[model samples]
Each structure stands twice: as C-alpha cells, then as structure tokens.
Target chain A: MGGDVIDFYFDFASPYAYLAAGRVDGLSQRVGRPVRWRPILLGAVFKISGGQPNLNKPLQGDYLRLDVPRCARLWEIPLHQPLPSPFPSLAASRAFYWLDQVGGEHSPAALARAVFQAHWAEGRDMALPENVLDVAASLGLERDAVEAGIAQSQVKDRLRAETEAAIARGVFGAPFFFIGHEPFWGADRMDQMEDWLQRGGW
Target chain B: MGGDVIDFYFDFASPYAYLAAGRVDGLSQRVGRPVRWRPILLGAVFKISGGQPNLNKPLQGDYLRLDVPRCARLWEIPLHQPLPSPFPSLAASRAFYWLDQVGGEHSPAALARAVFQAHWAEGRDMALPENVLDVAASLGLERDAVEAGIAQSQVKDRLRAETEAAIARGVFGAPFFFIGHEPFWGADRMDQMEDWLQRGGW
Candidate 1:
C-alpha cells in the first residue's frame, strides 16, 4: 500500500480486462509501480450493480463481434471467437485460483492468458473439463494440479471472497480500478490510469 | 463541415451532455474552434446500441443519485435532480431543433442548460412534452413557440433523421462529437475531443 502499487481488479469474462491485462505490465514498469492482479467474478459484480449481461442485451452477440476484433486488431492480440460463449467461467476461475495457490514458476499472468485463449483464442468452451485441461497443459501447468484445485472447496470460496471484496469496495464492473481509493471504470480510462498511478494517484 | 465548426451531438437526457453544453463555449474559445449544437434523441440511440433502459440498471439509478451531486459540485454547475427518469427527451430534442429553427440568441447554450437542468435539477422528465415547454419558458422563450415547434411534423422528422445519421456514423451512444468524418462518443472523451478537433483529427 505504501511503495507505489496499483491493485488491478479484473474478471476473466471481461473483454476490457483482457485488453487491460496485456498492457498493465508495461504500464507498471513505466510508472515505477508494480500491479497486483486481483481476480474477481464479473457476473456477481453485474448482478449486484444491476449491470446487464452483455449477452442478454438485444445486441449481446454482436457486441463482441465488433468490439473484440476491433480491440484485438488495435492491441494486435490473437482472438478466437467462441461459438457459444465458451461456457461457464467457473473452471477457468478455479484453474487460476489453483495457479495462484501453488506459487510456481507460472505467473498468474500466464495462467490468465491461457484461460483467455481457451475461451477466446481456441474458441473452446471453459465449461468442458477437457478444454480447461488443454489450456492448462498448454500453459505448461500439470493437469493434475488443476483438477485437484477445481475439486477443492477453496477455489469456489476464494472466488466468492474476491467477488465480495469487489462489491464491498464498490467495484460494479470488470476492468474497474481503485488507484488509491479513487474508482475509475472503463477501458478508455487507461491513459488516465497510467497518469493516476504514475502521479501516485493524486 | 468545411469550416472550423464541429458538430456537437447532444442528448437532453445525459448529464454529461448538459455539462458539456454549458462548458463547450469556453472550451471552444480556448481550443479555437466553433461548436454547433446538434441534438439527437438518446432513446433512439440506446435502441440500436446495447444500452439498457435507465430504470433497468440499479447502479445507474444509484449513480444518478450519488454521482450527479458530486459532479455538479465539482464542476460548479446547477443540476436539478428531481427530474423524472428518462425525462421527456423528445421535446427537449425538439426544442433544440426549434432553437436551430429560430437561429437563436445566446448560441443555443441556454437551451442546452435547460435540457441539463430539466433532467438533473428540476427532475422534469425530458421526454415529456410539458417539461420541454417548461424548460423553454424558464429560458425566456415564448411557451407557445416551443410547443408549436414540437407539434410540427417537419421538426419531428428532422429529429428522427438526426438520430439515424448518428447511428449511420458509427455512433453507438450519447454525447458524441464529429471532427471531420471521425466520431467520438461520450463526455469522458472531452479531452480527446479537443485534441482531435484542433489537429485536423489526424
């Protein structure tokens, strides 16, 4: 809390979070502060905040069609559009929790990327155990570890706690940030994010 | 379009637009550009884009209650908060169209403030016909003229056409600006709005 660190609150299902994740590392280095990734569930945030599920909107399906490709092209990231929304995010959330627990050479960032790719790049459903395992293996993580983590109660509990923390702190959406208690909500605010954190969030 | 003029697409329903409406004069003067008011119905824009009805979102209502006061206090603007949800925007849009019709004094800025205040301060429903007339009367415009304009078929048609033009220009939401062929959305982008309009929108 003291030395210049920005806690980046993220949700895996968020395209904006996916966009910000790719940039946070470089931003952190340039701003001379480290970013701590706090994984939170977006669905819960939306429910409490009264935010609509984008997929449920009248143009739900088409939004990602325009937004995803446009952002991917801008950031030059590879994206695989899922045919059916890549399924429940529970497993992907568990895998990241397990990855976070073990404290291996794998950065949360690597696991995060792999999970995004599982749903977004490979167009694979996250609900499928095989899909989760495939993405885990691809990230050089052992499938056994992921399976054990998913089966454990701690994974679900951890995610619930994270979501609760986000709600308690007034984070109503994904890619929301608290640069020293000031909430900035939206992807377009990244430049302000950089400036905010760079100036120690004045 | 060929001059230093920039089209200001505004919605009486949007508080940010209200903020912009009042401040744009000074912003234009500082940035050395002329801003032309172009009012469009936000309801139509929301229909095509993936935005929810105001009553549908809890945080929106919450933000309206909590954030508006703070924003007005910070920005030193008169924000009347009792306005009905989605305050009768049709007439508000129509009124701006009327202002454009009469070729007004005060540069359409008063109409802009009335629109903002109708929704944010007086709690007037901008979508309501009565509220539009009331706002116009407050601005010293003849009540009959404002109401007569709203009844005009051509004015209504023009309003609809502007909304369609907004959609056609890739505008997905409220408070949009056009710097040449490029369109920027939201009051959040005001800084960027100034930057682009000045630099020929490079």
Candidate 2:
C-alpha cells in the first residue's frame, strides 16, 4: 500500500465486505490513501463482541429475506441472496490470516476478492477445503501454500489475535475501519471515510 | 429547472428526504446533472400507492428511530428527530405546493431548499404561516407574493393535481424522482435528478 494507509480489516462472510472490496481501494486512492486490506474472522470477533446476528433479531429475518436484496437491486448490485446468510465464516476467514502468515507477502486484496466472490458471488460451500484451494488457485496463487497456512497452529492464533486486536480497537463488527481511534461502524460511511482521508484523516 | 430536468419529487416528513436534500445537489454537481427540486407529500403518495409506513410495523419504528439518523450523521446532514414525527402532514404539504406556485417559474430550487432547511435543518413548525414566510424571506423572495399565492384556489388545486400526477407517475414516496420514470427516490437522488437535466432524462 502507498500513500497514507488506512487498514480495512474485513471478512469474506459479509456482503458489505464484497462491496467494500470493490470500492475500498478506489475510495482510498481517490481520497489520497492506499487502503491496506486486513482479512480477519468475524466469528472470533463476534465471540468477543457478544453481538447477535441481525437476522435473528425479531422481524429482521423477514427484512433480510425480502428487503435486503430489494435494496441491493435498487443500488444496482448483483445479489445471490445467501440461503443460510449468517454464513459459517470460520474456514474462509481463518484462511486469510493463514495465507498472510505463510504466503510470503501475498496479494491480500486478490485473495480477499476471490473468497468474497466465492461466498457472496459463486455461493459455494465455504466449509470445504477443496473450495478454499479452488478459490486460491483461480486467483493464480499457489494452493498448497494456502493449505499449509491453514494447517499451522500459529495461523489460528494470529486470527484470534487479530480479532482480539479489533475488539480492543472498539470495532463492533466486520468492515470496521478507523482513523486514529475514531471508529466508524458501518459500510454506509464509505464516502465519509473517503472525505476524511482526503483531508489527511484530520 | 434547466436542461433535461429530473424532478425530484420529495416530502419533508421523510427522513430520507432530509439526507438527500443535504447532499443531492452537491452529488448532482459531481455527477454532472441539475437536480430539479420537486416537493411532494409522501403521505399522499403512500395513500395513492397503498404503501405502508415502516413505523406502523413494530420493529421498523426502532429501525427508523435509530437507522434514519445514523444515515443522516453518516451523510452529515441535520435532522429534526421529532418523536412520532407529528403524524398528520397535510398543511405543510399543501404549503410547499402553494409556494411553488408563486415561486415556481424560475427559482423553484430556492423555495425547495428553504422548505427542506425549515423542516429538517431548523425543525421549525412548517404549518405556521410566519415560519413559511421566514423561509420565503431567507430565500430573498418577497413574502407578500408567497402569502398572496397561498390564498389562491388555483395553487391549492394545482398542488392536489400535482399529487395526483405524482401518483400517476408511480411515485410511492416523497423525495422520489423519476429520471424519465427511472425512479430515484429520496432527496439524496436530487443530484441524480439534477444530472438528468444535463444528460437528458433518457
């Protein structure tokens, strides 16, 4: 990453993350910051935060089932409408911290994009190891390096550590970003984030 | 209203309208369009469209109370935040259309901006005659002409007709704009509406 960097710590289990992956880099670049992609498991983060899935909230399940895709269509983004959308993000999310450790300065952005596309776009099985490797190889990266990263105990620890770091930073959810200690906790603030960055995060 | 105009039909009662009002003009300038300000009653549009207010539903009331202002702050706009939002809006709705009749010819934009500021910015009582007059004065418009226009049966009839026309155009809510029937609802789309003026609403 070049310029003033704002680390965009994210997870593949989120549709918001998919949208952010496409726009975050461009947003940062336009606003004169190079956004650093930091992939971390939200499951671990949730465990720490004690946050409940929004769909499980009363009446929200219907909104997610019906309203969310309507909102996506209005914004002109493609949607698969994940069947079990509060996705079991463990394997795919762990894969990222895993890749970062062993993949030797890997293209975090590319890998993040591939897995986001896998879960949100292709609607593939995230729990499957074959699917994870398929996502890596498709990105023209070595698959064994990713698999090797996952098998290591340190990778698991790093993911946990990163999640704990996010919680300590006061991040309440996935797609959380920061400017110094200012926590903006939604995907909707993307433009404002760019505006703040353009002003050198003043 | 110049160029290939996109009339942003909107209501002050709607929170989304406030968000759109604050930024749509600037956004349109960025997107290269002239956002025509078309003030209309969302309640009337809902009446015609059979659309239910989300507030009537239990869970949505909380979401509205929370999420709407979050969008306002996220977008950096002012909000009134009146509890129960004063259910009946007919008088204010009529007044906007009435003002448009007097101020409609060339400077509808000024008149529309004042109304948005009054309702969303200052949280003034829109039903008060003095408040509306002050809004007119702030726009550097003659208060007498606005007062005179309010007494006209034609203006009132025309406002009712405008509501009917909005319904005919499939407008389901306030701050809904049609870029040649490509509905961009909310005052926030005003920039999009403005751009339609530049790009030809097709």
Fraction of the true interface contacts (Cα pairs closer than 8 Å across chains) found in each model:
0.16, 0.04
Per-residue alpha-carbon lDDT of candidate 1 for residues A43-156, written as tens digits (9 for 90 to 100):
888778767556556544454455545555555667675433624677777778777887879887787777776676666677787788888888788888778888889878
TM-score of chain A for the candidates in order shown: 0.86, 0.85
lDDT (10s digit) by residue, model 2, range B1-202: 3334456776666667667778777766675556666666666766655555655644345445655665566667777666325334444555566765544443666666677677766678676766777887777767787777666788677767877887877676666665554665554344334444445433
Residue A105 C-alpha lDDT in model 1: 93
Clashes of each: 19, 11
DockQ of 1: 0.20
Per-model TM-score versus the true fold = 0.67, 0.56
Q: Name the lDDT value of residue B31 in candidate 2.
A: 58
Q: Candidate 1's C-alpha lDDT?
A: 0.69
Scanning candidate 1 chain A in windows of ten residues, the lowest lDDT window is A59-68
Please identify model 1 stretches exceeding 4 Å from their true place. A1-3, A60-64, A81-86, A122-124, A199-202, B1-9, B18-37, B43-92, B102-172, B176-202
Judge candidate 1 at residue A147 and give its lDDT.
84
